[model samples]
Target: MRVALLSDCYLPRLGGIEVQVHDLARSLRQAGHEAVVVTATQGPDEPIDDVPVERLAIPLPGGVPVNPLAPPKVRRLLLDGGFDVAHVHMGVVSPFAMDSMRVALGVGIPTVATWHCVLAHAAPLVDAAGYVERWADRGAELTAVSQVAAAPLRRMSGGAPVSVLPNGIDVARWSPGPRPEASTGSLRVVTAMRLALRKRPLDLVKVVARARELAPGADLRLEILGEGPQRRRLEAWSARHGAQEWLSLPGRVTREELHRRYLASDVYVAPAELEAFGIAALEARASGLPVVGPRRSGITEFVADGRDGLLVDDDEQFAQALARLATDADLRDRLGAYARSTPVRQDWGEVVAQTVQAYGRARA
Candidate 1:
């Protein structure tokens, strides 16, 4: 089967959806299917992992990098490329993805639309848009990364099923290794995420500060990997709370470096409450690191409370979890051991099989 994985962004742009799109294409090929990536984000016309990437020249309005004129080209691709299925990954408000779905459906091509974001506050708008898109392509298969992300779309789907397809990670690549020895006596907490408002990087700093206050003499250090618009603000917050000395922002690193960082750290923390699927938390667990984060988000799918990791409901609870993990090495070791033993559903082959099943349903 030939599949076209459509997205608003692709390689050269580091994002969860972009990575998933690329991985999905590679997995599809590994499953004996031809796959291609059709994205609006500009990049060289080169094959990544042997899967061809088609980067369209799209317009950016008000600095929002999306192609307004993507529908025509998408329709042309569907009609000309002889693709067996069109799998469109939808962003929060992606015109290109939506347009691609519309064009694929209009041209009588099987289409699968995967929702990858949890629009917590802007759900009404998303519902409205989803309603219009569903009306436009009622036969298209709809999916979400998690149940929380599927709620609004489910309402828009009337009585139709909304499949839950969580993101997959390369388990072997993220497997546990010999943990790097900690140089400092302090507990090392690591978090990798974009420093965006939704990720709450500033709140993480505050949580680290609170943990210090709770632990008193127990030393704790935080290393945040990744960069975004909130870098300056997060730095300022760390300085204001006298946490600059203990907190280090190393920006972004390669995948190998990320795995090394996870092995080097004592614990992993995810502050994002709106994560559709927490890939970083999954990687942390695969790396033998116990995870600490809110109980309400998608990370709960993998991180079992008190087993693989600790789940909290509020900032104070988050701080207390950190404090406990920082002060107690035995508990950390036990949790970390359990985290390593626990198996997460991240096999790329399984993900591809499920995706092919969705494509078959779409074609039916």
Candidate 2:
């Protein structure tokens, strides 16, 4: 089967959608399918990792990944590519992806549109716009990365069913490893995410600080990975909380480094309430670390409360959970062992199968 992945973002612009779309294409090709990425992201048109990429990027200032004038080009590409399915990946505000979906449907191609971001707050506006209804009327199949992401879509889709098409991980790549003995005697807690307000990096820092206070005798150190605009604010907040020594924001690191850190860390924290899918937390879970995350987030898809990790209701509960894990070695060990021993169902093989199922539905 030949599939064209339509997205507003792609490789060289590191993001959730970009990475997932790239990995999906790679996995599709590995599964003996011809997959090509059709994106608006400004990058080299060269094939990445043997997967073909067609960039319809408009060179705006700051390399923004949006091309208002790419409709004609996108139409031509789809009409000529002989693609069996035009799989469109969308975020909350993906004009290019929506346009591509319209073009694909207009040309009578099977199109599967997947939403990668949470749309709770924007559902009303999107429903009012009636795009989802129109797409449904035109025989387009819709899906989302998780149940949390699918909820809003279900409402705005005008009774059109929205299925879950989760992001996948390389299980063996992040499988449990022998954790190195701690030399500092501090509980190494880690989180990997862009330091943005939506991710609530500062909020996580505060929760960790409160956890330290709740378990003063238990030494806890937090190292946040990834970089964004909130670095200065997070640093200043940590200083104000007098947590500079224990809380470290190491900015962005390579994927291998992240995997290594997860192996070394004792626990993972993901405090984002609006998280559509917790990819970082999944990686940590795959690496045998117990996770502490919001109960209402997409992390619930994997991290079971008191099983793989502790799910909290609010910041106070989040801090309490962290403190409990820090002081109670038995609980932490049990959860970590469970997390490590269990395999995540959202592996590439299962995800590819699910993608094929969606494509089949779109073709029908």
Highest TM-score model number: 2
Return the TM-score for candidate 1, rounded to 2 decimals. 0.94
Against the correct fold, how does model 2 do in TM-score?
0.97
Task: Compose the digit string of candidate 2's lDDT tens values, residues 161-194.
Answer: 9999999988888888989775333578999999
Give the TM-score of each candidate. Answer: 0.94, 0.97
Kindly state the number of residue pairs that clash in model 1.
0
Q: Per-residue alpha-carbon lDDT of model 1 for 1-364, expressed as tens digits?
A: 9999999878868889989999989988888899999988876788977989887765465335487777788788889999998999987878788788778888888888898988677788766756534633568888888887887777767678888877898888998889766433368999999989999999998899899999988889999999899999987777786777899999999999999999888899999988888888888888889999988888877888888899999999999999888777778878988877766776787777788889999989
Off by over 4 Å in 2: 181-186
**Native RMSD of candidate 2 (Å):** 1.5
Compared with the true structure, all predictions reach lDDT values of 0.85, 0.90
* Alpha-carbon lDDT of model 2: 0.90
**Relative to the unseen true structure, what is the C-alpha lDDT of residue 293 in candidate 1, on a scale of 0 to 100?**
94
lDDT of the structure predicted as candidate 1: 0.85
